[model samples]
Target: MFYFSVSMREVAFIKQNKEKWLNFEKTIYNNQFKNPDELSSLYIHLMNDLAYAQTYYPKSKTISYLNQLASAAFQRIYRTKREKTNRFISFWKTEVPLIVYQFRRYVLYSFLIFGLFVTIGAVSAAYDDSFVRLILGDGYVNTTLENIEKGDPVAIYKSGSNWGSFIGITLNNLYVGLLSFIYGVFGGFGTGYILMHNGIMVGAFQYFFHDQGVLWESVRGIWIHGAMEIFAIVIEGAAGLLLGASILFPKTYSRMASFKMGLKNGIKILISTFPFTFAAGFLEGFVTRYSNIMPNWLSVGIILITLSMISFYYLIYPHIVHRKLKTHVSTL
Candidate 1:
């Protein structure tokens, strides 16, 4: 009879706090912590409740419920602590890489569009001498020709102090990347336009070098940094496409919800390009200037390594990470 009464009292206690406990769980999982202090207070209150239940209702279902809630709260707290401590490490290791894996199809599509534009530019330049001059602009073409005559076709890369050029180029590239991403709000057409424009410019630029009979020389110089720079632009385009795609095909999610998720995810992918963009700019400013002096093999080697690193991180590492994460979850 005493045991029955004890069980009844435990049941009554659970009935009183069950809603609050469930609400806490909902808030924790949903990441609705606008006021972390409030959450901390609630956590303390929950711990106290768990202690009471453990002392009086040890073997009861009420005690079990409290224990689980406490455990969840603890886990959440521990996770939050880790996230704060390892914010940068977590971002590269998990956040950005996962986002890249999730939106790979967009990346491929962006790459195809860019490649098509490059081909168009190259073909146009090949068939029409006027086409290179037109696309590249008269002043730029004339200046490059003058430099070529001076036996310094790639002299433009030596224009500024290494650090000065690095800062300027990095900022410009970042701005371009940001614009490419921001334009996705227009249903991705803007991003495609940017990609097409840049692709044509690259093709025209390369063709001009070829027309001047400096194709190989220009490549050895420009590609030392162009590999990463160009690759980052393509990735940025992919991010924009993701934004446009979410709105066009929300699937089961509401349009707003889909847009929010896309925006969040797109930003992550864009951020992942920053380090590469900076590296490219650094190489362009400090190293590309000496392209004429560097050994052909050394220049080619740098370009190859840059391409490999970008390819592996954006294209290959994501797959490895996704598979590993999936396996980890399956084990759980």
Candidate 2:
């Protein structure tokens, strides 16, 4: 009805094309804009509608209506398919790098969080040897201690069917990761505490194992999965900091807008970390427990391999993706 007021020619054009336009818009709505071409079409239509609104009926109700329609169309199209770039190459080059850039700040926040937690844990452990048991349940500490006495300190990790363990552990770990990111809103200090609680647990766990004369065994066995698993935790901490920072500094947008944007980025980064977490969880549930079953050298080798893979994917890969994108941007 609104697109009918410019002239009889314009009105007749709208009447003739109305069904076609409605059909096209309906398709876009149903698809949620998975197809890039549909978005491009909507973009073109939005621009044309705005231009006509400004040209022929700048002060009319039809012009206002066209502007509203154009805005609605633009919002709908972008909301579902908010990708700023087109291909996998573009995503790697542009999107991936942006994640790394934003994530740098997250890294520092993570370190600071770990430091604070370690200090508290150390102070507590110094006051009482049982402090480690308090932080990591007595059941866990006692079982680990028995494993240490038996010369298989990391054996607690290995029990459960690989497939079931993989799915259950991965999904549960992801939920923990998401909760850590979401809890950053409580001034971010809460998220920092969660991270530190983890760091403290590790510090105490290692110290207890070291106190038992099996530090290297613990390192070789534990780190086989710890490298990837620890890195996943740190990455999750970074995500929480991102959400926290959004609340702390709104920048150009309102506080709500900034938080929402941070949450979006944080969630994406969290999802990206899943494959790594899954591998880590699998290793923890399957490999570390069986460290005693394997040769000492073989266990060490697995540790090195897992560490290498984590470093490559999380740190090295992001940089490579960033550099490649910069080259593409230069060429364009």
Candidate 3:
């Protein structure tokens, strides 16, 4: 009886304690220092205890007491979770790597799209001879041709001023990339046009320099920054398409909500691309521009370093962060 029965006196005491329990809950809710995580853990333990107590003390005042406590504890736990979820969202920058790694399908899709353009560029360059002069100006082609005849296909690279060229060219290239990214949303076909234009220019540019009899010079001069800059522009276009596609193909949420989410995520990705691209342009203008005077080995080394750094930062770091997050969730 002492172990499991509910006496008349016990019932009366529970009725009074319930009012006090509600007031105590309100007080805890209002506490400025209440930690949502601590409260959630505390309440979960309490809920488990109450479940065991309910089974042992069924049909007793103890059962009634445990039921009331479990119900109230659940409300508090939910409240705490809601607050934590909001805080988690507010501090989202810390989770960017995790987010990117989690949505790795998007990353793969962006890669496949860029690879298609690159293959197209390579195939066109390999096939066409006069296509080079038609796409690159004859004046530039002739100059390059003359430079190659002199055994220096990349001689033009040795002539540019460092700071002045960097500032001017970086701004111009960034503007072009931004234009390509932002204009894609207008009709969904606009970006493909820009992409084709860029692809044609690249193919022609390479073939013209190659026809001058120094394909390696063009590769060394161009790919130093083209590697990063071109990659960023393509990714920026993917972000734009992500935004546009959300609106056109929203599945669960209202179109407006999906678009808002897509726009926010896309804008973040686009903004992040800016610094890398500007750095690429800077390297091209100041570093690659002087490659003729500089040792060929040094330019090659810088290119390798730049590619390695980009891979580590955007690819490896994000994957590591995601792995850590998964481990943490499982432990919780």
Candidate with best lDDT: 1
TM-score of each: 0.75, 0.68, 0.67
Which pairs of residues clash in candidate 1, taking residues 3 or more apart in a chain or in different chains?
none
How many steric overlaps does candidate 1 have? 0
Name the candidate, 1 or 2, with the larger lDDT value. 1
**lDDT of candidate 3 over 1-332, digit per residue (tens):** 11334666656654555455454445443443266565555545545545654665455646544544444343344344433456445233334554345444555665566566656765676787666667666887788788788877766655568777677777877786677656656633555556666766776677666655677887777778877777677666666666666677554346776677667666766666777788897887777766666687887887888877666656687767545543433344
- How do all the candidates rank in terms of TM-score, highest first? 1, 2, 3
Winner by lDDT between candidate 3 and candidate 2: 2
Flag regions of model 1 displaced more than 4 Å.
1-85
Q: Write the per-residue lDDT of candidate 1 for residues 1-332, one digit (tens) a residue.
A: 01123567777886777778777766665776665455666677777788888888787655555554554444344345435547778778766776777677899999999999998998888888898878878988888888899988888889989999999999999999999999998899999989998999898899889877999989999999999999999999999999999888765347897799789889989999999999999999999999999988999999999999999999999888767654443333
Better of 1 and 3 by TM-score: 1
TM-score leader: 1
lDDT of 2 by residue, 236-299 (tens): 8888888898899664346886788678777767766777788888887767767777897898
lDDT minimum window of 10 residues, candidate 3: 90-99
